[model samples]
Target: MKSLLSSRPVLWFLFLFNLAVAVVAPFVVDGAQGVMTAVGMGVVSLGAGISLARDRGRRVSA
Candidate 1:
């Protein structure tokens, strides 16, 4: 798990894939479930992508 998370390509893939899920989940899922699906995936995508970017910047500069 640690090795996987540290891989930039893998993170990029997960970030994009989850972002698509966040966007499409609302239409595909139903009712409140759709909201949950969207929110959950959205959070994960944003968190992973943005945090990775921030960390990268910090690491590169440091």
Candidate 2:
């Protein structure tokens, strides 16, 4: 899991994919469920981006 998270390409892909889903979900779905789905996706995207940034920082410092 840590190895996967540390991969820059994979992290970027996951972040972009989740961001795309979050952006498109509103037009495809309806009501509170749609909003919740978008929010969840956004959160995941943010987490992935943060993880990538942290990993990069650690690599630089080490």
The candidate that wins on lDDT is: 2
lDDT of 1 by residue, 1-62 (tens): 88878678877887999999999998998999998989998888887898689879999999
Error of 2 at 34 (Å): 0.9
- Highest-scoring model, TM-score: 1
Off by over 4 Å in 2: none
TM-scores for every predicted model: 0.82, 0.81
Q: How does residue 62 of candidate 1 score in lDDT?
A: 100
Cα lDDT for residue 28, model 2? 92
Distance from true location, Cα of 50 in model 1, Å: 2.0
For each candidate, the alpha-carbon lDDT, in order, equals 0.88, 0.92
The list of candidate 1 runs beyond 4 A from truth reads none
